[model samples]
Structure formats: C-alpha cells, structure tokens
Target chain A: MARAKKPKLAVWKFASCDGCQLSLLDCEDELLAVAANVDIAHFPEATRAVIAGPYDLSLVEGSITTPDDAERIHKIRRRSKRLITIGACATAGGIQALRNFARIDDYINYVYARPEYIDTLAKSTPIHDHVWVDFELRGCPIDRFQLVEVINAFLNERRPNIPRYSQCVECKRSGAVCVMVSRGTLCLGPVTQAGCGNLCPPLGRGCYGCFGPMEAPNTMSLAGWFREKDTSADAVRDLFRTFNAGAAPFRKESEAHEQR
Target chain B: MKPAGSTDPLPAIIDKGGLQVLIDALIGGGFTVIAPRLTDGVIALDTITSVDHLPAGATDEQEAGYYRVHDGGGGRLFDYATTPQGWKRYLYPPEERLWQAKREGAGFAIVEERAPVPRYAFLGVRACDLRAIGILDAVFDHGRSAEPRYVARRDQALIIGVNCTRAGSTCFCTSMGTGPAVGTGADLVLTEFGDDAAPALLVEARSPAGRKVFARLGGRQAAAEDIEAADAAVAKAATMVTRHMATDAAAILKRNLEHREWAKVAQRCLGCANCTLVCPTCFCGSVEDTTDLTGATAARWRRWDSCFTSDFSYIHGGSIRRSGASRYRQWMTHKLSHWWQQFGSSGCVGCGRCITWCPVGIDITEQVRRIKDSEGGPH
Candidate 1:
C-alpha cells in the first residue's frame, strides 16, 4: 500500500471556549511523537502557518451557532476525507444550546445592549446536524486520552476504542466509593457517558452530566430515580436543560418535566 | 483457614498493646498491612503504618443510597465494617496494560507485561468480603480463562478477618449464607470484645503462617469465656441483618421470566452499570488494542466492562438487550440464576455494596422480595 507523505491533520474551531483544543495541546508527552509522524495542516490554535488542506483527518470543535459558522462547516466537510467532531459542542449542541429552549431574538435582546448588530442562528446545532461526520467524540472538553485514540484510529482506518458506558464504570475502577451513596449527593454519572475521568463524584460533588448521555441511555428510569431522591421537578428539569440539553434524549426528558 | 486434620492452634488474648505488636510484626516482615481508615469523608482501606492510623472508633452509617463515616468517640478497633471494594482492586486492577508491541524489522513484536506482586496483610476484613475473595478466586483462577495476575496476588496476600458484631442497614450476608463469621478463608481471625472503654481482641490462628505471627505478639492464652464472647458477637450480627432476600433466586427468577414486575423495577433502573461496577463479584471486562501514530508501537489494554451497556450484548445485527427492562433482567438473572448453574453458587455475597452505591437507591433485596411474592415464586 502506497501511503501519502505523513497524514495531514487539521483542527477547526467555531463557537466554543477552546477548552477542547487545549486538550490536544495538553497531550504533552505524545505531542512530540505526533508532530514527527503527522503534519499539522490547518490549526490556528497551534500555528499561524496554515497549510491549506485536502486533509487526511480533520478534528472539528464547537457548535454551529452563527449562520457564517453553519456555512463554513460544510466547506470543511468537503475538504477533509475523514472528519471527527470533538467535545460536547461538536457532537451535541453544547451548553450554549440552552438558547435553543428560547427564541434567539429574546436571548440577544436580554444579553446584548445592541441586539440589532448580533448575527446568529436561532439554534446552536452540532456538525452532524448540518454535514456528515465520520466520528463524534463526546465530552464538555473531550478527554485527551480519547483524543489520542481517535487520532490513532483515523490513521489505522479503524473504529476508535471509546466506551459507551456510564461514568460509574471509571468511578468504580478508580475505587471511588459512590458519592451519591456515601454523601447523599445527587450525581449524573449513572446516565452520563464515560469519558471525563476527573468527574465531580470522586471530588466530593455530584456529576452534572458533563459528558453527554451514554449510548441508548435510559433517561426515564434515571429521572424516576432522581425523583425518588426527593429532587423537585423544577430542579430535575433545570438539570436536563443544562449542557447537552439540545440533544434529543436529554431534550425529551427535560420537556417531559416542563409540565410540572 | 487451617486445613482439615490439622491441629487447632491455641486461641490467645490480644489486648490493645498486643494488637500494636501484631501490626509492627507484619510490617517488619515486609508486608504492607491494609486497614480501614478515614480519609477525606469516606472510610477506605488504606495502608497503615501505625495503630493510630486505623479507624479505631470510626464507624459508618449505611442506608440504601447514603453512607456517612462518624467518630465513635473512643478507640475500639474492629468496631466497624467498612469498604465494599474488597481485595479485588489490588489483584484485578480497573485498567491495566496487558501487552506492548514495537516494530521489529517488518512485523510487530508483542511482549506481555505483568505488574509485580505486592505482599499484603489485610486487616479488619469482614466475613462477607472473605467470602467475596473466595468467589473471585473461583471465577478468575479456576475458570476457563485463567488470570495469572489475579492468582499471583491472591497467593501472595495474607487475609486477617475480623468477625462482625453488627451489620450494615443494606447487608443481607445471612441470607447469602456467607457471613456473620469468618470460617475458612482467613489466615487469622480477630474478634474485638469487652467494654468499649476498655477493649481487647481474641486472636485465633487458622493457618501455620498466622500461628508463627501470633507467636511473636505478646498475647496471653484465651479462656473459654473469650471464645463465648466471640461466638456471641457473631450471633448478634446475624440478628442485626434485618434486610432479607431469599437465596433461592434461580428457582424464583426462572419461573418469573415472563413477569410484569420486571418492567416496574426497570422503571427505576438507570442502566448505569453502577451496581455491577461496585459489586465484588461482577467481573466482566473488554480488551483494547491500538497502534500509535507511527504504526511502529502498539499496546493492548484491559478495562473493566459492564453488562448494563448496549454494546455489552452486541452481536452481528444489533444489541440483544435493547430496552432498559431487558438489560436489568439480564443482569439480575445472571447474578442470581446463571451464576449458580455455572459456579455451583450464587454470584451475590450480599455485602450490600451494589445497593448502597447505586445512584438512584434501587434496592436488590426489594426486587428479590417482589419476585418471590409473585405467582411464579416457590410455595
């Protein structure tokens, strides 16, 4: 098999805190190894020297909030052979998608003094909601280890070894006694996917669903459990409306409780 | 415990001073003594250097979904039953690199890597966990897929069980028929007796290794009353286990396969796998293999997996257990029914870790009771 000179990797950003991009940088030990084997094509966060791509692998971060971003992602989708969306922003609609619950005009008028100047879409949407994605990495700030795994999988033409189970798996492996049980704290590790290793549970706080819902999550059952913990209907609704609330599973669970 | 036909070693009285002598002797003999200690807000099994480091007067209050460690205001070692983590974590790690590969000429060369075994002396190991360690030994060491790492750890480690005087709110060890007393797994059994203000321990050797260690400690010979107090302590603990689940789970669940109550229980299930993860006997794991960016280096990793996930039962077409109801049924059925058929014993040791650690407070005992009350239940 004839291989093209080292695979060209491009990183793109849209509407996000750049926390996901920072995770790629945070891979200090593996960065030198990656730099020698792969070409850093079009990463604004890492370099201003942009090597225009017909890239082999592209990592897209952040949600599509603005109309310009919505159009720009389609172009990126066309340029890259395999595009993987990283973090909650690029996979789900992200925390900013809280605006999806209300009218965009109402949000702009309330937050910005000059509402007329704001140019944005009605809903903060994910890349898959617009264009096709080869893979999606789910996390508020994607796990660095998973980022490495995704890159490795792309190079080898294989599926990324990512877990579709809940955060409880990692918590248990770490020998973390359940905070919900040991401290009476409400945690979302039960329904949330396993990606973020340093979740709030082991740190004396409950999981706030930082990672999106696990594959085929049973939100209804989890909600019932929450209700049994004496959590108010309003509180449960508010929780589901937080990060990744625009995702269908979480959205449905939140909307079901809106009646109360 | 001592083998059959072996002479029973004389029981001895280990006062507060004698207990310290035992700890020092174990450490001096190149063994790390792990005991229950208060750290942060939880009582975890931690390596202890001194008797003061132990959770002497500290005991935890356990409920369906709540646990809180509180100080008992006096030094009374072995007064508390702590940690459901068991001895599994040290032996069977949560995540471990199984093998590493590097490019050699054209083909990759893989080399297996095993962690060096650490000799440990487990202190204050309750009877329930002693039973759990035995169950794990049967699963990993004697199974078709033998794990040498787990067996190595088991062989190197020393068990010192403490008899339980009281049971946790979630405990049902009596129903599981594995607790209230340490029988055959421990090397040495320690029973803290006498008044709380002035406490003493009765130390009995169950193995030759324990007898040698006990000979070093300056404990006096135990009297007949000392033995009676120890037996009475175990009896009281058996009575304290109010939560009951019929052990005939295989019989009850097999008849109730089509029951509607499964859906009712599923309504409160999260499919989080928290129950399985925290369970002492739930051993299901998946292996992962990947190469680095250069394709020159590769590593194989093993991580603990849970059956609650959709991917756990995946086949060529799709996941067999798609709905939450199906996943919950499969897990409960496997633990209670299939395990007995396969291992000649129930998977559950009834330590109550699964119930207490579950995020939503779903009680296993309650589910078992509901099934037994159904039409399919045995009369």
Candidate 2:
C-alpha cells in the first residue's frame, strides 16, 4: 500500500464576514491544484469533510471577539505544525476593533435584541495577540493571488514574494496621474501596503488601506501631505482607523487623531 | 522614421462615413468594438456600429460636484468629455466568478473556469481615460504577478484613443501630467481636425499588437502640418480646463489626518456611496453565496462593494466607521493621502466622475482647499 500523505491543511474562522476565507475559494482554478498537493484536512466553509489533525498547515481567518473563540484557537495552535493568519480580522483585529475605541456595551445594546444572550469580549484582537502566527496575510480579504502565493511558498519551503512597499510603487509603475498632486485629491497610496494593485487611484479615488500598513510606514509624513492638501487631522485619523484599524501603526495614528 | 514626438503631418484623410467601414473591418476581423454612445443622459462605453451612434457634436461641462452636457457645434462626433463609467467595466469588471463548486458524494468537487478573453476594440477612448487604463494596467497587467483575469483581457484587447478637443470644468489631467493629448499605451490615436482639414489620426504603435491594428487601417503616414494641428488641438483643450488642485497635496494630506475640518465635510456627505460606485478604480468588493433549495450546491460571487457601506468594515459585532464623518474621511484620505504609500502614486486620475456622479455634489477638490486654508494643523 502507498504511504499516507504527511501534510494536512486546516482552515479555521472566528469573527468575520467570511470574505477572507472566500478568497481561498476564490482561487477557483487554483483550488484543486492546491488540494492535490496537500491534504485539506479541514475547511468548514468549503466543505463538510473533516480530517482530524495535528495538521501540517492551518490557515486562520477572522479575529478573537468571543471568549469561546479565544480559548478554541489555543487548541488549534497546539495541533497545527504551521499557523498562518489571513485577512484584516485575523491579523489586525478587523473593522470590529472599532469597539476598542468606543463603548462595547452600547454596540451590544444597539445591535442585539438580547444583550445578555450574546457572550462576547470587550475588544476584538488579532490571532498574533493570542498565539504566534507563522505569517500574516493582510487585506480586508487577502488578494486571491497572494493567498495562492503564500500557500505555495509554505508548501515549497520558501519565503512568499509579498511586497512590503506602499501603493506608491504600483501607482508610479502604472503611470497614474498623482491624484493628490494633479487633482488635489486625497488618497492613501503613499502609506498603505501594495497588494490591491492600486485599485482606487485610477478610478479617480484614493486608497483605503484595505491591505493594512506597510513595513515601517511613514504615515506621519503622508498625513502631513493630507493636511497640506486641506485634509483635516480628524479626517486623517479616521483614515487610519479603518479596515485594519487594530494594526499597530494605524491604531497609534488613530489614537493620536482622537486626542486632538 | 519619425521620432516619438515629431510634429509631422499625415497625407491620407478618411471620409466621416469611412469610420463605419473602419469599425466594420475591425468587427469583420473578429473584434468586439466598443465606443461612446449616448445613454441615459450620459456618454457611456457601449456597442456601436456607424458614426451616427456616436455622441456627435456633444460636449460636457464638468466641475467639482457638477457635470452637464454642451452642444459641440455640430461638427465633431467624438467631442464629448468622459462619462461616469470608465474602462474598468471591461478590464476589472463589476463582478466576476472566481470559481464554481459542486458537492461530491463524500466531499466537494470544484472547477475553475478559464478567464474571459476580451478581444474587443475600444474606440473613442479619451486621453484621460487612456491614462486611467495605463494606471490599471500597472496594477493588473504589468505587475510582478499580473492578475490572471486582468492579464487575459488586457492582452487580447485593442485600444483606439481619441485626443480631447474640448475640456470639462473638472478636467485636470493637464496638471497631473497625464494628458489632454493622446500618449503612449494606445494602438491607434485619432485627432479630429474637423471636415475641412480631413480629420487626422496620429497613429503611434506602442506594441506589435498595436502595429497590427494600425497597419490594417491602410491610412498613409502623417505629414508635419497634420501633426502640428493635433498638437494645437490638445493644447487648446488643456487651456479650456477650469479646475486646478495643489501639486504637493500628498505631503499636505499626510500631515493633516488630525485636522478638524474633516468634520465639516462629513456634514455634507450623505454616505450614499455614489462617488465610489462611479469611480473607475474603486475595486473594493464583497463576496456572496447563493444556494439551491437542497443547499448542496452553491455559487460564490464577487460583487462591487464600497467602504461607505456600514457593513463593509464590520468585523464581529460592530463596524469601524460608525458615523458619516468617519466614512467620508476614510474614503477621501485613502484616495488622496494613503494611496501613494500603497501604490507609489495617488489613486485619483482627475476624470471627475466622482464629482459629477455624486448626488450631494461634494467636490473633493473643494474639501482639500478648505483643509489647506484652515490653520488648525501643522503645515
């Protein structure tokens, strides 16, 4: 008999809209190619088929927003050989981290009919906050191509080719008219990470930081440009506090905006 | 051989009706030809046949928060300014099917469909619109890893860019260093000098693919005077544009995130998401699944979504931007300030679609001017 395959892939979710995991399914043509290489032991969103682990790779999505989820992730971490967090929710606490700045109880009361029935944590936190993440794929929904690239890298034992630079690199390469300079339009391409491929700029719009902050982002200087363009500090603060609001640099910048 | 920027004129002139024959030739060669047609009170990219279908003698008056039609003196057919829709509908698409899945006996089987090939000829494309397409190509086609879907369409399509003889009030491509004149990235570029001057087209072949399309046209090479006329036409259009935004806006916006004036702009913003929907490059989307009655089969779809939506930023139990002010701030700053950090340039192309399509008519340029004029933040 042929020897059983060793590598097992597991997908887990927490508090999210499921957009990130959908990105895995969005791989469409790439899905079968990926599954052929590895044993998809667990992916509840894609299939009901479950294979028990210790799995070789685990792709985690969403954020830790409930007490139960917080405890459950630990067991997953122990069972997984390599754990990677995917999307804004899992890596940056998601847009739900907005609760960190405001009153969580007010949200509970406003959204839910019976606040008592809903068991939740005070603030949404990233998987990295709880356990070590081998890698973190940024974006509200990680770009499907990048998702494939990450999976391929891990399978081949190599580093992923994800860029750490800002959207500016993409914009210049595409020869886009500088929205801010030419049109005096407000945009976030200068400080946000390059992944969404400068989607907003050519549409005559700005970047919304869906992919989160880049490595050592010069957000302060970019914020200065926003001001010079007549963007208010509060407006700039709000920009930082979006999508990947809980990310460290964005969080710090947003907090500073709130202080003013 | 003419240099890339030589002011040489062309000898041959096609009759106004000859354009139909040209389009027919393209279609005959198995190309899906798309051009601007008057639709629902706006010029949009739609399928067209003869020159009559074109928005002949139509012009547009575009300003911050305003766009209206103007009569184009009954001579030029492709005289209208750009509409709310950009070429993204063809390149990026509003929604796409990433894959399809079906339940197997024990698990699930999935089939990924081949990306659609866009073997179409885009006619009457404006200089600004061409610039916008170039920007998208950078993001979608020429990247270290091109989006397979975008690449398929981009590789197969042909572009026929038109020089703008009229400028809208919101037009600022001249300031942004993009164009009022046609630039590279086009297969064939036409500059209309009206009937008497034999409407000349200064064709530049950027790629072999472009050369093939131009070679098929059978038009003679341009002369010095024809080249000069095209140049004069572009310069005239550039002068007619009324709007102007600061050049150093990125640096200024980057520093003023905490300024209070955002609150003022927020007051006028309705959060209806008109600006984002009409934007050519706003590619943010959401995913959905529709299942049959048995629930065994489902089709997952990617739909256009906006950050302005309340649920867009929702994580577990709540949303990040709870107020109209925060959402507006998020949209504007991302477009102007943070886009540079992410893509290496500002995201906006100065087409003014957002300004015109916005129901509330919130002028982004005006908002920036207000923020810059205020003294609360560090300049």
Candidate 3:
C-alpha cells in the first residue's frame, strides 16, 4: 500500500501587529485538527520548532519594509508550492505603508531613540510587490473563520469562496439603514470587503478599510458624496492613505490629492 | 385577513402589563429574549425577565450631538426613537473565545468549541436595526460558504421589529432609504400609535419560520383601521426627523476627495476610537492570547478593535497614520466614499450612535458639508 504524503505548511511574518498570524493560533481548536492533516513545518510565532521548506503551503504575514525582508520573501517564494499572504500588511503595504507618502528618515528619527541602529527602507511594501502570492486574505487581523475556509479551499484544491464585493452588500444583507442617508454619517462599507461581517455599522459606526480596498472600488463617487455632506477633500484623501495606504486604489486617490 | 400593505394592520394593541406574558411566552417557547433596559441613563439591550424591566412610558430626546431622557410619554413600554445598542451584540459578540489550547506530552493538544446555536427572539428591534441585521445576513449567510458561528446564531434567531413613532434629531434613515418605518426584514413589526390610542403592532412574515411563529402568536387578524393608524405613525415619525442628507451624496463625496476641508475637522477630532465602537457596522477587530503562568496552556481570544488606535495601523516598527488628521480622514472616507466602490452600497446605517457618543460630539454631516463647501484643492 502506498502512503499519502503530508502537505507541508509554513508561516512567516514581516511588519505587522502579529494579530494576523495569531489568527492561526486563534484557531486553537482548529489548529491541531489542521496540523493533523498537514506537517507543521515552520511557524516562529506559535512554536520554536522549525523545518526546512519546500512547503506545500506558506502563509506569510506583514509587509516588506527593509532590503533584507524584500530579499527574504523572494527566497520564501522559491521554496513554497503555494504562497498565501495573510492580513492587510501582506496584501497591501498595511498602515505602516503610510510612511510611503512621507520621508522615511524623519519617521525613523521620530520614533527611535537610537536612529543610527535602525536600518530601514524608503517604503513598506506588500508580499506581492516582492514575490508571487497564490492567495491574499484581507483584514488587519484576518478573520479566523475566513482564514480556515481559505486553508480548507487550498487543501481541497478549489477556489476559496471569499466575496469580492463591497461592505454595502453586507449592509444590505444585514438590513442596516444607510447611516449616510438616515444620519448623514460617513461610512466605508460600500468600498471595503465583507470579511469582518457588518460590524461597524451595526454598532452605529462606519466601515474602516482595515480589510483594505474591495475590487475596483469606486472611491471617486463616494468621495463626491462626502463632499456634499461637507467632508473636506483633504479628509477624503487622508482616509484612503491610511492602513492600506499603499494599496493601488487608495494610493492613487491619495496621490491625486497630495498637496506637494 | 386583509392583504398586507405598506401599513401595519390590526391596530395590534399590547397593554404595558401584557409585556411580561409575551416575554414569558417567548422564553417558554425555548427562545432567548433580548430587550432594552435603562443602563447608564441610556437605553441598552439586555436579557429581560418581565414587563417591569421594560422602560415603560419613557421616551428619549435626541439632538444633533446629544441624547437624553424626556418625561411624559404614553403607557407604551417601548416609546424611544432609537437606542445606542443594536442586535449584533448577541449574534456577533465583541470578544469571542474562538478556542482553547494546552500542551499534551511532547505535542500540543487543541480543543475547538463550536458555538452553541441558540434560538433567539430579538424584541424591540427598530426598523433601522432590522435593516442592519439584514446587511449582516448577507455577509454571514448569503455567501457560498457560510460563517459557522454567524450562521448558527442567525439561523435560529427570530426578529421582532419596532417602528419609529418619533424620529431622532440626528436621524436621516429617510435619506438613506432604510427606516422611519419597518418595510421588510422582520418576523413581526410593532408600532406604537399614540398615548390615547392603543399600541398597534403590524406583524409581517418574511420567511416560513416567521409564518410559523406568527401563527403561534395567536393575535387577532389585523383590520384596515389598525394599519391606517400604523401608517399614520410612520408618516409622523418620518416628518419628525430634523436631519437630511442628499441622495447623490456618495457621488459628490467621491468627487470631493481632493477638497481641502478635512484639515479643519481633523483639528477637533481625537483618534480615540469611540466612533467605531459605537458604530453598528464597523467590524475591524484584533486577536490576543492569554497563557497560564507556566506558559504551558493558552487560550486565544478575538476582541473588538478600532482603526483609530495607533496600534491598529502599526506596521514594521511604526504606525501608518502618525497624525490624528490622517486617521480621522481614513475613517470617514472609507465609511462614505470607498465603501460604495467595494461593497456596492454605503457602509453607514445612520444610527447616530457615533455622533452622540463621540464625547467631543463631532457631527459627521457637518464635517462632510464643510469639506464640500471648502475652496482649497485636495491635500
């Protein structure tokens, strides 16, 4: 009888809160069950145990901020059969990418007491910028349930059933009254992806792009609405330039509004 | 029975005393009933026992930047315009224990706790709140693969919606095309007509499950007079609202992204995250793990987090939004502008919780208008 080979799984981190990687550990009950099916090859955050890769699945978290990290991702790409970027940092440049719009040296000096000891890059970039990623899980800290679905989909050799639509669909499905229409409140549900469920709005708040931009987000139209509502252009521009600041749509929008 | 129309039928009158019997009936039917009670001078949702716990004859006075209690209302128990709390708390808790873990021998052992699906009856849910729940259903249930936790709670839950008899000063659900009246998305919708008049509840069945529950309620079939009263109540509430936003506001917001009015609003804003927390649809969150003293056992938790926090946008060694201005801008734009691009609808539900709870009282409508009126170019 022939024995089935166990799939190798690896987890990597870059520039982020470690919340996204914790989503895996957050899968406490599911973790062991997942490990049972695959070989726990490399995960520095969860366990010290390390295994050489040629990994069947690689879950990379955070973004590349330094030259070393940029090069390291390329090496990871070569060794993994399928590379998946998890969280806002790995897919977009993350909130840290906000520095991409400003001077890096100034920011470094502002935070670090010993700026000389810090070796950094001009910009923080997503994994896709450095290497190919088979799948990208959106969210600041990716939804664990959704994360599990992605893993299961990959394991089953099928496309993940992640929604590419905006948060508005979720708002509609939730049957929430449009805050902008009823309260004249600004909200991001229409442009944000539907991963966090309809959390902010139900709480009487608007959606923030922690999950990053949705597919082909129509930011211009939404911004126009904000303008009529009295939201300033600088305010709209600044909104797109946060967390997922380096994302294409948000980045382009912010650049269009750049003062200098 | 008369055909169901856009109005409530049967002038469904429920005495203030009957509330306990209704609640008891729901509980006896193996349903967990959640209702609003006075908490910190504000109406908040909590599990209830009887009619005594309901805020009877109480009404709230809501303003553009304030919310307060007002005296002298009918004998009706649920007379408030809207509450700060929504239905998401029971369905999607702020902090949930995803699972627990421990080290076993040389290897580690993990245990997954599948959330117990409870049969819930959400009582006193407002029209806007019902709409919010429907939006959540799309995200949690409509997809090809359902979210196990969300699906479990939603599938077994029953909704009892309440129509707005009075509008809040900040309410603009009419502009959003969501509320003032309960249009759809409810197992039953109740509207309080007036003090002189009996409390009328218009019950409509949206699903087979709802129909079953409706049949069990044993209420008399609604008549035209009952529905007429209900219609009058909704119309009165719609007219009571003082705030309004343009329908084409989303498109205008998109075009004005480069407008210069943001700096002024940013000046007064503090990125404290109160707005996100009070929001009905804001879903951004973070995860944490707590280990025993021995570090041998650990339990991971997922908690509510806000983007307004410095740590929320942290990257590499620092944060992306180093200034309050940028963070505030990010939050508003995502909520109103980019939301349409990503989700095909606006993110906000117009509950007005953020404005009332903002501590500093930042009115979103005013902020948007200022930006729109500003002459300076994009930042």
Candidate 4:
C-alpha cells in the first residue's frame, strides 16, 4: 500500500541557447503526465527547486566550452545514473563549435571588450568528448517528441527508436517531392540524419543538416556531386559547416573542401 | 451483375468529355478517385472531382537525379510518364498504427487497429506501376501471413491503367517486360491520342467492375483507325525508352554478387535509401513500439524501412550489411535475382524512380549492365 519513489530527472545547460531546454517546457500537454511520472529534481529553467543528487536521469544540453564547465560535467556524470546528450550542441558541439576551427585568443580579442576576464577552452567540444554519454538525441533544437521518447525509453528500460537513417527516408515516407532532384536545389538530406521530421525539404528548401550526419554517411560522394554540379567547392564546404559542424564526418568533409 | 472474372469487354472510343463521365461514375460509386495532377512542380497523385484536375497539356523531363515539368505543347491528358511517388503509398502506406494498449487495472487491454478502409479508384496507373501492384499482391495478399490492412485496401481498390505515350529518360519498362502498353491487372485502361486534332481516349475494361463503369460511359465503339492511332502512341513510347536491363539479370546478378563493380558503385552511392524509398516494389518495413509518459497507454506503428540504413540488418552485435557495398548489393540482388527465387519474378517494375530520385544519380540498369558486362571477373 506504499507508492514507490519516482525517478529523478534533471536538465542541465552548459553552452547552449536554452532552445533545447525550451523543447521540454514546450511539451505543455505532456508536461502534466511527465511531472506525475518523474521527479523534476533540478531544472533551473523551469523551476528554482533543486533536489540533491545522485539523479536517476540527467538530460544535458549544449557543448562544453569553458574549462570550469568541462570539470562540472564530469561531476554531473558521476552523480547521474543515465546521462543523455540532447541537441546538436551536447552531441556534436553546437554551432558555436565553428570557433573550434580558429584560434580562441584571436576570437576573444576580436569580440570581447575585456579579453582578460573571459575564461574558455581552445575548442568547444561535445559532452561525450569530455565524459561518457549513454545516448545522444541529435538536432539543432532536439525534437520534443524524440526527447520524450528517449526519456520514456530510459524509464521502460528499452532502446530508444531514434532513427539513424538519412532524411531522404522520411521525405519518401511522407511522399514529399525531392527538392534537390525536382528543383535542382542543393540539399544535405542524403547525408543528414532523419530526426527533423523531413522539415526543410517540403517547403522547397534543402535540409540544413540540423540533425548531423547519418550513420556511416557517404559525405564524400554527396559533396563530390554537389561540387561537380552548380555548387562551388566553398559552398559545399560551408554546407557541412552548420549546426552540427563539429560532428566527425561533417568536420572531415568540410575540411576536405577547405580552400587550402 | 457480371462475375468477378468475366471476359474482357471490347475497347471503346471516348472523347475528352467522356473521360469526365467515367470520373463522375467512380465518385458516385463511393470511390475516392486518385489521379495525376500537377502539384509542387511535379506530376503527383491526389484526389480529383473533374477531368480538368488531370495534368493536361503538361509533361515532365526526368533524367538521372533530375526532373523538370514543361508545356507538352498539346492538350492531352495523361501526357506524363510517371510521378516519383507511386500507387504503393495508397495500398501500403508509409506508416500505420498496428495496435494500441491501454492499462485498466493490473493488465492492459489490447486493441487491434480496425479503421475503415477506403475504396480507391486509382486513375492514371502506369503499366509498370500496375505490375508493381501485382508484385505487392504476391508479397502481402498472397502470403500465408497476409497483411490485413494491405489486403483490405487492395480488395476495395479499382485500378484505372494509363498507357504511356512518352517515356522518361530513366524509364526502362520495356526491358522489364512491364510497360508502354498495359497488360492484365487493370479494371479499365486508357490510351490518349489525337491531341492536336480531336483529343480522344480509348478505354478498355479488363474486369467485371471495369465493365460496369465502362457501360456507364455509353461511348461509341473504337474505330480501327482510332485503335491504330492509340497503338501507335504506345509504340512510340516504347521506342523513347533507350535504357535497357539485361533479361538474364536474375542469373547474372546472382552469379556476380561479389563482383568488383559493387565497390565501384558504392563510391557514388550515398546510401541515402532514396532508391528503395521511391522504388515501387521494395516493400521492406519495420515496427516501433511506444508508451506515453503516464505508462497507461502504448501503441505500435509500422513504417517503411530500407536496407541502406545501418540498423536494417541489426542483430545482437552489429548490422550484417555493414558496408554501403553490402547494403547496395542486398537491395539490387534482392530486386533483380533473389526476388525470383522468393516470388517467381523480379521485384523491380522498371519504373525508374530510383534513377530519377537518387541524389547521386546511381542508375540500376547501368549498374546491372556493368556487372553483366564483366561477369565472372575478379571478385
């Protein structure tokens, strides 16, 4: 006749725009059910309430930018039973990871009024690059339903059903005409992962690789074709250097097309 | 009413106006009429009420990884070869809920999805697509463990075949022995001709249901010359298709599964799975189970899957088809060779959607020819 204690769920932010965290709050209808199921222990964005660890599940957002934040994540990892990296930031070092390509001190001197006050790392890296990540839910801003699915899977002790296939599969499944083939628009749907619900292509815009490179993505083949056709080598390079620019395959691809 | 397998009715000549009468009859008979119309800059199948909804005076140019719509120069309905999206989506949807479970007390109550299936009259069904449907029938309807949803939807469907007067550059239906002129499966078949002069259609009923719809048209019998003109139009379409698939591809592909050409193709292949997704008869699907946050309800969904995905061949350790070469080999070999062993026929209907829709433009016919050309070479 006793109710069991609920699993503690924590949402952590490091170097993100807080958009990924907003996805959870945006689950307005499912929030009630989610609240009932899990203990919202330490979500500073949603509630000032802070419950002590070790937390049952921690949903980490944003990349590890500062050295202090890097050390803080390892502590968070130690305190959490299951650590999931949500959004392109935590999984592949967000758009800010574009800074990873250049000198950090030069960027600091160029942008900051007080360069001496700013404390950061040489490279903006993903959480998994610093510590172990149980699972990664990819997107510029992660799909809320997929985030829910990942949490639900953790609760149910099952593998999450997030797809690792190209966005073209979703386009075909939804019967969306291929923007690239039909209109000669340059699209990254062939190499980008399929968690965005086939977003940009249907609107006559090409996929921007928001969900990062798909599993074993043939980036070279796609880039080669794009460069051979209307797209310039620089354009093709910049195509892979967006939201998930720090992802390994994309990083290698963009570097391949470097003007040097 | 005539029996279901009644003999074929004679072909009748119907003007452009008579085509509208047939559309009305189908709509009146409580069927959702899906026809080819221009949408999103390409010919697509969608619901229509009148014949004007069809893509008249319009045609498309399709090549490997390219498609463009242009003025066909003549006021003829059914001028296009085939849309990238096929009739498969109607019979076998991209995704469907299989069942749902809701917790009551200690146990949950399982509810099987029994949603009412719609009776569809698919207008502008190309010959190759018709054959693709036949292949799907074997996969879903004819099997012992028949898919209930597919069987119900297919049973309540009416096929309105359209003979191709012009072929896309990617099309090779003649090599596949499937198109240019329709054979067998349709309830009614239409051939468009005399676009510059009269703009007439030759309608033939191949089934009893089609005969009933044909009788409703009350059109004049097709003259010998009208039939000749219609035949000539389809014959020209056959000549337009320059691509060819080796007739002994089934044997040749099976023999050369480990050919060096597989690796060569992998270099150009993005492994995007667009080829399989757009393919008419690929027919691979996977199921996903999900539960709500409350844990009170759970549902299972079936969605189209492709071998190009790493997880498609996942077992305990890792995927069987780990390399792009292996996955591409599995798809092509299954379509051209293993399909015959499993279903007594090739899986590909030569619709050429794979060629047109592929981002990298990897042509299946060309790949087959390359493998066949260097058959029994170094593995």
Predicted candidate 2 versus true structure: per-residue lDDT over B1-379, tens digit per residue: 2455644333344556557767887888788888988764556678887777877767766655455566656657767677657787787766677777787867878868776486888987887788777767766765576778877888878888887877877677776667787777877667777453235445555556665655566666667777677778778988987776667667667778877877776655545455776676676777755443233455666656677766678788888887767888888888778887877777777777777655345777777877787744554
Expressed as tens digits, the lDDT of each residue in B153-268 for candidate 4 is 99999999999998989999999999988987899999988765458889998888999999999789888888889999999999999888989889898889788998999999
The prediction achieving the highest lDDT against the true structure is: 4
Report chain A TM-scores, every model: 0.95, 0.95, 0.94, 0.98
The model with the greatest TM-score is 4
True contacts kept of 2: 0.00
Q: Evaluate chain B of model 4: give its TM-score.
A: 0.96
Against the unseen true structure, what C-alpha lDDT does each candidate score? 0.83, 0.74, 0.72, 0.91
Clashing pairs in 4: A89-A94
Which regions of candidate 2 fall more than 4 Å away from where they truly are?
Answer: A1-260, B1-12, B142-145, B195-202, B375-379
Off by over 4 Å in 1: A1-4, B1-6, B376-379
Worst 10 residues of 4 chain B by lDDT: B1-10
B260-367 in candidate 1: lDDT tens per residue? 878887788888888887788888888888788767778988888888888888889999989888888888988888898888889888899888777777888888
Candidate 1, lDDT over the whole model: 0.83
Candidate 4's clash total is 1
lDDT of 1 at A22: 89
lDDT of 4 by residue, A54-145 (tens): 99999999999998998999999999999999999999999999998899999999999999999999988999999999999999899988
Residue-level lDDT of model 1, residues A1-260, one tens digit each, is 22467889999998998999889999999887677767899999999998987998899999999989989999999999999999888888899999888898999999999998999999999999999998999888888989988887877777788888888777888877777777767677788888887567778888888788887677887777778779888888887877788888898889888863
For each candidate, report its DockQ versus the true two-chain complex: 0.63, 0.02, 0.02, 0.67
- Interface RMS deviation of candidate 1: 2.7
